[model samples]
Target: MGIFTRSIVSRKPNESMRLIVTTFFGVVFGFLIGLCFPKLSLTKFSLSTSILTAIDFKYTEYTKLGPSSSTHVSHPVGNNGSSANVTLRKIWVPSNPRGAERLPPGIVRAESDLYLRRLWGKPSEDLTSKPKYLVTFTVGYDQRKNIDAAVKKFSGNFTILLFHYDGRTTEWDEFEWSKKAIHVSVRRQTKWWYAKRFLHPDIVATYDYIFIWDEDLGVEHFNAEEYIKLVKKHGLEISQPGLEPNKGLTWQMTKRRGDREVHKETEEKAGWCNHPHVPPCAAFVEIMAPVFSRDAWRCVWHMIQNDLVHGWGLDFALRKCVEPAHEKIGVVDSQWIVHQSVPSLGNQGESLDGKAPWKGVRERCKKEWSIFQTRFSRAEKAYLKEINSTSR
Candidate 1:
């Protein structure tokens, strides 16, 4: 009985050993399967390590390296891609009795003869199919002394729109000396009103090309014929020559917020360069010397608000009409005329002590600018809509 009991105990021990061996082999087999087929594994250690390594390497390259550190593209045409083309027809000036007397009669006669010949020339006839360009000017009392000079400078088929703003008799008599020039005198009651209303209209329709210039802005070293040729080549709607003020004007620079001292210094040194797109469009001045096509003048005249108190908003008003339509406005290579630098209605206000008549004018201009912006925005929207609809 003792021997049988001992044998039973030994058999139990062997069964226990067999169970332990089976469990160990089973665990090993499961581990090998997991390594061979990653999708079966719960830990996912090997796959995770590979994905992490790839991400880290990709980020390292992208964050630390690439092209496009120092390159710039140039755009010669304006953002809207327009070019200026202009043709010169007849040049017009305005003057008074005094201005006429100051000018030389001989010079006036010479100019008149030259202009008559040019007007009768084949080229002028071919361009306008008309014999004359009704070049006209307004004359003030102070302008009589330079009448001859003015006449000599602007030799063309001419008309003289005389304005005797000053209370004086015999003013019309002064212009009688030039038989080639037509003269009309305005009464004091209607001087300003008439001058502003009809200043350029009569001749505007008479000529395909028109130049409205101050009497004092005389032409020197210029051939109107050559200028006309160049303008025709470019096909500009409005054109002006380079205007150099007799005196230099300084431009001011101001600092912007968050700009470093170094950047500010650089900008100051650079001043303002020509705009990438429109070379001569930005910050341009000199209303005294612009030449306009018949089309441009018509556009401007129609676009001008009747309520515009005076000619103070002419530049800004014209820009609004042209820029959006992608019309060409340009400066010519020729230095055509010398402006006398006379102050007009808007300039009456700028004083050293700040008491200027133009404060109201400035405010009006600001309001007008705002209105222009709104109008342009609406126009742009309309244009885009038309383009989209057409494309579809």
Candidate 2:
């Protein structure tokens, strides 16, 4: 081997051999250099990836934040010579968070309510007890006596809200309970109009149940606490106190059944119902004194059309919000109320085209009902079409 090596060394190499030797050594040197410095790239890359993953996890995990809470995060960015300790702050903010950070958590992000607060008391001392239910009456001064009677039936567990359509809110303060009641004075508006504006789901979220009632109803035979108990026991999410069968009752479904405590379905006129479980035959209640569970109100509130103030067709469509509507929607027959059916709101309308005020108002109610039906039908069709397309 020494002799062979000596012979090769003695021989002069060609230009191609020199070039080949240089190329081979160059390739090997580059590979060694790469292996030596691999840790710089691999270690930095893995560290950065881990840091980024941790930051991402924090962002998703801390979706809700208390007023005093914060996340302190530090991440090194860029290369070693120009690296920076990047402080990333993902502050919790409301949807419109321009100045929300400085406000109290309750004022900024908590569920709202209509509780009357004292001007002088500490914030926490404003309410002695938080009511579990909300009862709203769209009333006029003419029906104050009736409203007073109705309010008496509900206990302190309810928050009394009066929508004075006649613009006489202060007058209601004569009653002892009215001092604590929340009154909204908006003239010449229907109960549905008041409800849509003031009874937003967010505003009433604290209440377990919400009663949107007309002022004409008489609560002589009804007990609000008992009604709540019966509805809960029967698993009724949407319900109304049954109407006295004798007093100009429009539908048999709403008429009080003396034999039963609560009724889920009623036999309507022949061909009145499309199916036995559908509205009028079942899952039906008149809107006069309808009560809604918090969850049910969320859905029902969305269905109340902004333009259709009379709420003519809303009762029928309420079943859409609840599942097994026949089982979940019903009437508490034992806690029945008398529907006085006073045409007071109709008098609020102005005479138009030689028509009486009430006549014009009734006409609008009927017209709104037709418009609502058409809108509902179209909305259903559009929804079905979109669903079909997406499914395909």
Candidate 3:
């Protein structure tokens, strides 16, 4: 009788244990099977594809909130709401969802070959990872050689974007890498316009660094990989390649020095004193070839005023992006580029009435300086006032 009771109890526990083990294995096996032959209709909210294939997904996630929505802008200032003053500038929406045929002005549709689904460039990952660098150039037909040299140096490590203000897209067809690049060909658009229209900070958030380079930089002394190595080592958030000294040198701080990999301070030349807030000796780099880190570009893009196409007054205010900007911004000397100083964009554009194209641009630049000062002053005052209020 005792043996019978013991056997019965032992058998009950053994059955329970076996049941648990079987259940666990069954669930795991089912999950794996689901992944290999996943339901095609499964969405972001669906058990995320059983966690097997989910980990290696190459496509962008369409979240519960959905893919990013298109931008809709309404002009309230105009009588017919068709025209706008400076306050209501052009309405530009750069990105659209896949299969979206309607698009904003100046937003070119990528050729079928350049679609995001089929695109390949620096990331190496199959559209799963962010690019480390996004290099941009404003070029003309005459600047092809310099642009080619730059593309060759950076294309493997960065996603190269070429903005042709001269309006010819096929000129670079001979270069094999041209097919790999994201090219925007719009006639007479300024560098700033291309940036405002296409390279919006949000659109380029996947990139870690943004290099807004001019077309005429001589890159013989520069290596893109070496420059990046120095940038990472020195912890620079906004930087540029040191310009070759005596090659139409514009600023003391930008001059290449043989002794250093990077420089934050520069000595004042004989006749000029380095102003505390002035550039080339402070946190500023000339727009000719400025490189911006991801976070820094966000702040810089917001500060870009509408109607300021020349971007003349921007370098002075670039400090607004990164705190202690002088320390965070520097010129890399170990890998530097020579500025050819070719005025490619100078001769083209719609000029002011009775004014030459270059002259009209000059006037606009001077006017933008005043506008920038006003905006900066007001912004600083508001910021300080808010800080003081919060501290109390």
Candidate 4:
């Protein structure tokens, strides 16, 4: 009975030890199988989420889809002996939209065919802005060198119109700077004739001043910018530069003195007289270089009779434009141009009916002066009569 009892106790301990050893070996074998075939799944165990993310990151080439691969990836696809069911997707995106229409004359309106533009280059409903000065010169082929030098003096703020009398572009177009000027090469017409035809008062009403200059001027000492500044300062409506004293100065008012701003009144000698209506002390400038104000030019353009192309009798009668002609019409002494006195145009006077061109021109000048005097007297009497009748 004692021996059987001892045997039972020893058998029970041995069975317990055998069960523990079997359990440890089974656990070790399962862990080894899991490491070898990581993708393999069982009903009881699943793959680690960190391991799945690391695998996805390693295969994706780090394309930065949101913050993590799991953010855009679908549900973990089961590998049931078939290919993994995977889906490529983008994260959430916001919408982009256009703005509202508020303003008129939009791109569509401006591009419409109904638009009428006022621009000289391309007409639109837009108004035009005119330049400060309109400078016209009657250029001959022989005096192109002089014109080149004169154009250099301008600051390029004014418009230059060149009327070519000789009508040859070979000499004038040879200069590189002539491309900037508006060259009008016409045949058999004088400067005044061209002025009458092209430079109508209403067309040039946009400019503040008009410069009708001759071609034979030496502008070595002259600066157009400074001349404009001085003209505005002196309040001159009709003005010209003082001629070089040594050159041909028929009128004393146009003579350059010893560095003065202006010379409106010349001194009277024992024999000379200062007439209120005459030049030298009155408002007058030579035709060689005359700068007229817009308002004054409007008046002067009307007084220039259509038949009187010589422009003689015009300088003396310029007081009709501005009443206080002496104050408004004076010579600028600060900036002066040299009259080259080149006789290119002077020698071109021709007569078709056996009379010399110069002789015809001279005779016409004398006749125009006489006619202007008679016309002035009639105008003055008419004005007086009107004033007297109005007073009554």
Name the candidate that leads on TM-score. 2
lDDT by residue (287-333, candidate 4, tens digit) is 88889888988898888877777687788888778978778888898
Q: Give the candidates in order of TM-score, highest first.
A: 2, 3, 4, 1
Counting clashing residue pairs in each candidate, in order, gives: 30, 0, 0, 8
Evaluated with lDDT, which candidate comes out highest?
A: 2
Per-residue lDDT tens digits for candidate 2, residues 26-97, read 999999999978888998998788777666755544345443354544444456634435433444455534
Could you tell me which 10 consecutive residues in candidate 2 have the lowest summed lDDT?
A: 81-90
Span of 10 residues, lowest total lDDT, candidate 4: 96-105
How does model 1 score by TM-score? Answer: 0.45
Q: What is the lDDT of residue 15 in candidate 4?
A: 99
Error of 4 at 82 (Å): 82
lDDT of 1 by residue, 17-57 (tens): 99999999999999988787866463487557646744544
What lDDT does the true structure give each of the candidates?
0.47, 0.87, 0.76, 0.73
Ranking by lDDT: 2, 3, 4, 1
Cand. 3 Cα-lDDT? 0.76
